[model samples]
Target chain A: DMKVTQMPRYLIKRMGENVLLECGQDMSHETMYWYRQDPGLGLQLIYISYDVDSNSEGDIPKGYRVSRKKREHFSLILDSAKTNQTSVYFCASSSHGESSYEQYFGPGTRLTVL
Target chain B: QQQVRQSPQSLTVWEGETAILNCSYENSAFDYFPWYQQFPGEGPALLISILSVSDKKEDGRFTIFFNKREKKLSLHIADSQPGDSATYFCAASEGMGYKLTFGTGTSLLVDP
Candidate 1:
């Protein structure tokens, strides 16, 4: 079965605290992405990693960073948590040489910053 | 910059009715368009997609009608069910799906 998993489905942190969001996929997809969804802004891409240690910034990468040390795992980190940063985070993966660039998404993580 | 845009921010339709969701993009470079569905407290899932080469693509009851010249597309969900009630997002990418930009989304409600 193809699946993507995320740790800490729910998280709470205080202001100025560091936050980590981890994602793992079973399909060994070559590309992984991090995104955050807001009420009116929609799904905003934070980062995209093509492979291990190869990453690119998305539309909203100002307060976030991503790391991909393995083909199956990707992580999103925030140096300082702010109330404005609180939102649901999603991790997605896609493979090249496929019929199309269809992205498979993980459940997601809800983060709250106080 | 909100390159992609969705209209009718919210829509309500009776079960078995057809629900139409519209989307438009600002960039001519975007050749791929995909529609994603998101339920409450869940992640968005790829519902259907279309390439610039195709004007229409269908999967079961979901269909995408694209007009490349106008840079517009619409998703038509036939016989929508209550289970189909969710937020629908329209996304675009310049090359494949490596990087995507999504629209605000349209909240759909199917009344059974």
Candidate 2:
């Protein structure tokens, strides 16, 4: 089955601590994205990776970093966790081309920083 | 600046009523528009989408109306049900790639 999986559905971390959110997809899609969703504010794009080493910053790339070392894996790392970074993080992937606009999202990871 | 804007922050409608969520974009390069539905504590899912070439697209009770000149589009959900209550987001893509600009989102509540 085609699915996107996110490890640690929920996480709690202390300020200044480093955190990692892992995402994997079984579809072998060419494009992967990370977005953070908050109340009132919609999902904000953080980063998008087209290939193993190609990565681009989206609108809200600050305070967050991503790595796509493999075709089916994309990871988001928080260099220093902060209270303001607490939000629901979503991982998605899509194929290459115009018709692949739709993104298949994972269950999501809710991170809390104290 | 926010590339896309959504209005009515939220809407409450009775069952069987039609719920209309509006979205507008500022980028003229946007050629594709898609609506995503997100449930509480869950990831958003693709609901429906429309292309610049077509003025309208429909799927079951969900329909998307696009206006290329206005750079605006709307999602109409007919016969709103309690299960349909969720957050709706409108997204636009300029050229290609998986990069998309999303709206602030409009939460819909359907009371039965």
Candidate 3:
């Protein structure tokens, strides 16, 4: 079955600490995305990776960064965790061609910054 | 500013009743609309989608009604069941655009 997996399903970090959330997909999809879902904000995009080493910032990219060193892996990095950064993060993947815009999401990572 | 918006922050319906969730977008460039269903502590899953070219699309008991002129769309759930009681989100994107703009979800509750 096609699937996307995220590591560290739940995380807690102190303010100003560095954080990393990992994601992997088996479908070899070319496009990967990172998003943070808040209470009334729905899913706010953080970053979009087209392929290995090709990443673009999304609407809410101010406090986050992403790395896509391989086709099957994508990582979201928080240089300095802040209390306001606490939210559920989701990783999604999709092909560039046939499944142009349909994204398959991972279980999600709930991060709490104290 | 939120490009996509959903109405009726929360809705309660009885089983076997039809539940209507409304959505509207501000960007005219958005042509593809999709609805996602999310349960607590889980990721959202794709439920149904519609393109600007088509006015209606149906799958199983879920239907999407689109209005290109009004930049609005809605998801109609026929015979809503307790299993279908979950948060529903409306999302939109431009043609071939990899990014999607999502709206604040509409929470649904189906009483048995």
Q: What is the C-alpha DockQ of each candidate?
A: 0.80, 0.80, 0.82
> Which segments of candidate 1 are over 4 A away from where they belong?
none
Instruction: Please give the range of 10 consecutive residues that has the lowest summed lDDT in model 2 chain B.
Output: B93-102
DockQ of predicted candidate 3: 0.82
Tell me each candidate's TM-score. Answer: 0.97, 0.96, 0.98
Q: Which stretches of candidate 3 lie over 4 Å from their true place?
A: none
Clashing pairs in 2: none
Q: Best candidate, DockQ-wise?
A: 3
Once model 2 is optimally superposed onto the true structure by TM-score, how far is the C-alpha of residue B5 displaced, in angstroms? 0.9
A1-114 per-residue lDDT for model 2 (tens digits):
999999989999999999999999999898999999887778898999987989999888999999999999999999999999999999999986645667999999999999
- Tell me which of candidates 1 and 2 scores higher on TM-score: 1
Per-residue lDDT of model 3, residues A4-45, tens digit only: 999999999999999999999999899999999999999999
lDDT by residue for model 2 (B7-61), tens = 8899999999999999999999988888999998788899998889899999999
lDDT of 3 by residue, B1-112 (tens): 9899998899999999999999999999998898999999889988888888899999999999998889889999999999999999999989847889999999999999
